[model samples]
Target: MMGGLSIQKQRRLIVFAFITVPLLLLLTFAYYPALELIRLSFTDWNGISAEKNFIGWANFKEVFSNPEIFGVFKNNVAYFVVGIVQNIAAIYFAVVLNGKLRGKNLFRLLLFLPYILNGVAVAYLFGYVYDTTNGSLNYMLGQLGFDKLSETSWLGNTSIVNYSLASIGFWRFMGFNMVIYLAALQSIPNDLYEAASIDGANGWQKFIYITLPNIYKIIELNLFLTVTGALEVFDLPFVLTRGGPAGASETFVLKIVETAFQFNNYGLASAMSVVLLLFVIIILSVQRYLLRGKGE
Candidate 1:
């Protein structure tokens, strides 16, 4: 008004002012860090060093060429498998909970309680559960007449260690996924189900046609999140196994942390991070393409 600006122009100026602050914050905190990661990927900066020598493609080349380095993906594959199973279970439970049930609220609370619990505490709790000498799991198994199985090392043995850690991830996240699925399921129009039922559509048919179609987006979103989380799994392995048993349960992200901190190779860690970012982007793109195609 002092500048004799029109009301529309004044409103636009206000909107721009409001938008600018958050945009600047996002650029500073999120985008800047991401771009820095990309920049660091091309250099040999040992985190604390004054010199950041540009190494071109050498870090990426070594990441691929080193079989021992790339083999940690197998551990991720185990988590991905568990994530897939977790997604299925989540959806199944969500569907069931969406329907009428006795003590539904209690069950829902119980199912979601673990997701809200402290992750570090859960990891520590499982450590005791999987302990060799006096763990409750072993005691219970032995009591149930599985002495040989109870004697097995849940986190020590290389063969099943990844799966053991993967189970922790599965348990930790399934309830959250179920809550997502439950919300998506509840959002669907019940009228659609009623119409399908009136047209002689059974539960399976209604689910296949109406439910799946309505919730397909949520399903894809869950799968994307689950797969990405699986690829980035680090906490359980870090806290429980420390990626031990000769690196049998190390995750890609854990490897990145190890390279940057433990091994003092920031360039390689950044390159690994860049690779993981690219891989996640590719996966997200492919999933959207396939899901959009199927939707059509």
Candidate 2:
């Protein structure tokens, strides 16, 4: 069919074919499933049932009316707050590592190592660290003479359990965020900093004017990712606490899983999923608008 086509046209056709095939596959596998999930949210199906009765807004109504749902959302908000702290810490470390420091590469490697570990493994590892009696943390507190903290149950205490889980998230992800910020820092032109220094700009002033401006977009991107990940956090919390100790650490995504698999309320779970998705979309849209306004 391409026998009469020019050579450049033939090359373009080949490239288009390569792109089109994967695009089709992505639509078929990824988008199709997502659309089906949305459709399922409006029905009454136990996932194992042969009949899926259309229930209009009933599932959404149930989700909105449930009081427990608010608590799950509050936990998600706490996760997002902790994620903000993680990004701040990551940026600080990235700035320090980008400086004239020794063993920077080694430090970066050590920090990033946790991010590559399996989530389940990390969860179990932290589970031991948070054990009430035998955990390393309490043991260290004992050695430090803070005997009172040594007996405290890290994961069992309702007041601080969510913070404890959020700390694990920080530890696991701070390094990854640091690496991203480091890359962004390196991309910033050195000449800009030199120019600022020549004008007698102090370290803090230079950071505010040059560093922050240059990496603002990267920071926005990271915030978007952090917020989405925060809202959808599941694996670590699931494995570590099973959303237990009086459901103090249950995340929104974990609640969805519990409702669907444990409670066999597949339709309700789907409705929750859709609500979460819409919430994410709205938040991201606001973030985009703010970033655009700042850029302008």
Candidate 3:
């Protein structure tokens, strides 16, 4: 069909066709559903209902006024704070593993193993680990002579339940961040470090001046991802605690699920989902702007 066309025009046509098909599919599948979700947020529709009543802003008003909603966001904030600690731990592991150490590849593989497991499997595994009676953690504590802590309810107590859940996120994802940072670390030029060493710069000084500056972009990217993951966390908390004992571990996404599936409040759930999406967009936009400004 393109026999009469110039070679350049044929290549351009091929490229356009390749791009247009995926772009069209993306708009059809992804963006269309997203637009529908926004539309649903403005109406009162039980998921089963054929008729949806247009109730402008009512769902939003209810979501904002609910006391439980505030607690859900509070849990999200707690998760985000814990994620910062997780990022720091990942950086430490990455820095150490990037060195000329024996068995580093094996160690990296082991650390990253948990992240590749199914979320449901990880949840069940950790559930057993955190179980109050006859759990591995309690048994270990007993063996270590901390018998008092052996009987402590790790997932049942409100005071520590959020922390317990957050720890799972740390364990599962820290290796992912470590691998990213490790890649960044390996890409740093050895000449920079060599030059620093000749100038009598110590390990800490070299890290501060040469290593940190070179990998700052990757660091920012990891931090942004951590924040977003923390905000959207649902699976582990849902499978392990069901956002309980008494909603102690309730996250925003879990709340959205419960609202839509359990209570049949599709409109309210949609509203909450839109709000969460907007919150993430605004946060990421601010982060991108700040990073770009710093780069400039």
Candidate 4:
């Protein structure tokens, strides 16, 4: 009993025990892989190779210089644009649903339901909806006596193919964005609105002067998520079109996968991933800079 471990030592041991496992996991799974990716980015190693030849920044150079390689960003732009529109729509809808309307919770659920559904399944469902023949959209159009519109190939035409895929993303993410906005809206103190009302402020004025200011940080968060999500979009297109119609809808991340697995260009793929990471940092930095005085 006299030589028993002190309480201080026991507390320290407990703390160490609690943190040790998580620290090991982070190093092994997260830090190690990220470091490996950066290392691989500088090498010209095919996916299966044990020998990774250091090639400096040739992969990066190719990424920047080659029009063919950078062209995939056009598809990403579609998602970015769609995401912007989706955010606007979601925020507005969130505002409306925040009103004293009946069945608002049901409305919120219906909006958020798509987001909780399986992404692959939604893609497949939309893929069928956009099918060239016997698709629901075409069938509906035909029924409406618009045979010419009915014949239009939604997913096949290169011109609108990216947009068609982005529409699916819009459908899937609108609810999620709305839920975010709604949560932010709910957090604002009702006292602010009462004060606004006492000051002869109407709904629109209250939204602009009170609601908007109160939820500024949340709006910033939604903007960041929208941009980043746009950049990293892969699943919808991969599931629906497989980036088909002659790579018309191939997103940036999809192209990365194709580079590594399909073309055995792991080095380029790794470099692309690095570029994407840098892009996210740069984008969020710019976003913060622009939004500085306005929001934060």
Candidate 5:
């Protein structure tokens, strides 16, 4: 029995080692760099310099004092709000596509196709679309009765650039969300709808009571994903506006990258990154707490 126990312990150790090695590697490679960045946020160290000096709270104060940072923060919030709208729109579109319709597969493919393109490529494409002179938008507007319309620089305006970039997010992810909702919709039993109809419940009533409640878990999951995705928005804005003409469209991730790579202020960027991580955790926790359900 003692020899058998020893053999069991040895096997367990081997299994644990197998599982732990990759995770430890990930932490070593990924987490240490992140932690180092966070620690650096307390200091003033240029990326190229070997000399590191600690300046506590100063970097944070500078970050907060800069209106551009907060302006970018506002842009992030706006993107979050727009993302909710986009998710709702995606669900609606998904519901439509899930219905028995011709070219439904084609519609799904078309909608999701934009997600496959490189964000930088998409930015350049839209740049041409919104170009002030001889652009497609201006040409369309001119051809329309709005001949007096000014040729608007869609990517250049601080006020509209965030939304313009967000529109790309909407177009790219809407199809993905639609597919998720479509899968959820398909999972819902048809008998519930039939019963609702038998009870003289109208379409709206069925949708509100049956369809929504059934898909609430999916909604919760998707909302969590969208919230995180919105918070971490970088590529689209970076490529489209590079935080823009006046630092208007900068997101939290973009700010972090700019601080670390561009400004070589690694410490401040890490601090901001930690804050962003905390923000995401809080948002997700609140959402999960609020959306807790029997099914989930």
Candidate 6:
């Protein structure tokens, strides 16, 4: 009995090591970098040769007080709002495609192709589309008796740059969101719809009662992903507009990049990042609460 117990103990130790090793690696690589970023947020240090001082909240205050930062925050909000609409549009499109139709597979593949394209490539392509004078958009405008609009600077104008950037994001992400909604729609049991029809439900009634309720979780997931993606949006706007003519489309990520790498203010960037994290946490919490309330 003693020998058997010793062997079992050794097996348990081996199992524990196997489980813990990967966790340790994940913590070392992922969690440590996040923690370090948070730590840097509280200090005054440049990423350059290490000679650092401590300053609590000063950088955050500066970030918050700046009009440019606030404008960027507004742009982030617009991005999320626009992204939500884009996802909704995708869901609608997915629903249409989910039904039996000729050429459906080909259509889906065509729509999804853009999402698989390199993001930088998409950004540069739109850059040409939004080009002030010699672009395709301008040529179309000239044909539409709107030649004046053709010369308008899409990226340079503060009032419209965020909208332009959001449009690019919508185009880039719509196909991916459609695929997600399509998967969710396919997962739903069709019997529910058949049952609803048997009970004298019409198309609208069936959709409202059967389709919407069944896909609540998927909608929640998509909402969370869209919000996070929009909030952290950087690459598209970065490549297309480069935050543009007057920082019109700048986002928190851009601000952080400018602070850390451009200005060599690593500590300030860190503080800004911490604030951004807190802001994201707050938004996510509110979303959870609202979703929970709705479900109840």
lDDT of 3 at 143: 98
**TM-score rank order:** 2, 3, 1, 4, 6, 5
RMSD values, in order shown: 2.0, 1.7, 1.6, 2.2, 3.6, 3.1
| Backbone clashes in model 1, listed as residue pairs | none
Candidate 6: pairs in clash: 41-270, 41-271
lDDT of 1 at 49: 88
What's the CA error at residue 139 for candidate 5, in Å? 1.9
lDDT of 4 by residue, 228-280 (tens): 99899999889877887898989889999999999998999999999999999
What would the per-residue lDDT of candidate 3 be over residues 1-296, giving only the tens digit for each residue?
Answer: 99999999999999999999999999999999899999999999999989999999999998889989745888777788889999899888988998889999999999999789888888899899999997999999999999899999999998888888888888888898899989999999899989999999998998888888888998888888888888899998888889888887899999999999999999999999999899889989999987885522
Candidate 6 deviant stretches above 4 angstroms: 1-14, 293-296
Number of the candidate with higher lDDT, 5 or 6: 6
**lDDT of model 4, residue 233:** 91
TM-score, every prediction = 0.94, 0.95, 0.95, 0.94, 0.86, 0.91
Cα deviation at 45, candidate 4, in Å, is: 0.6
Error of 1 at 96 (Å): 0.7
**How far does residue 50 in candidate 1 sit from its true spot (Å)?**
1.1
lDDT tens readout by residue for model 5, 1-296: 34656888988988998999999999999999877877787888777788778988887787778776544677877677778998899888877887789999998899889878877788778877777786788789988867756467777888888887888778778888888898999999999989998999997898888888888888888888888888899887877678877787878789889888988877777677777788889998998787776443
Q: How much is 47 displaced in model 3, in angstroms?
A: 1.2
Q: What TM-score does prediction 4 earn?
A: 0.94
lDDT of 6: 0.83
Q: How far is candidate 2 from the true structure (C-alpha RMSD, Å)?
A: 1.7
Residues 1-296 of candidate 6: C-alpha lDDT, one tens digit per residue: 34656888988988999999999999999899899988888788888767777787787788789776655777787788788899889988888899888999998888788888898898899889888878888889989989689788888898988888888878878888889889988988988878887889997787787778877887888888888887788887788777876777888898888878998989888888878788778978998888894522
**What are the per-residue Cα lDDT tens digits for candidate 2 across 1-296?**
99999999999999999999999999999999889989999998998989999999999998898879746888776678899999999999999999999999999999999999998888899999999888999999999999999999988887788888888989999999999999999998999999988999999998898888888988999999999998999987799889878888899899999999998888889999999999899989999987795622
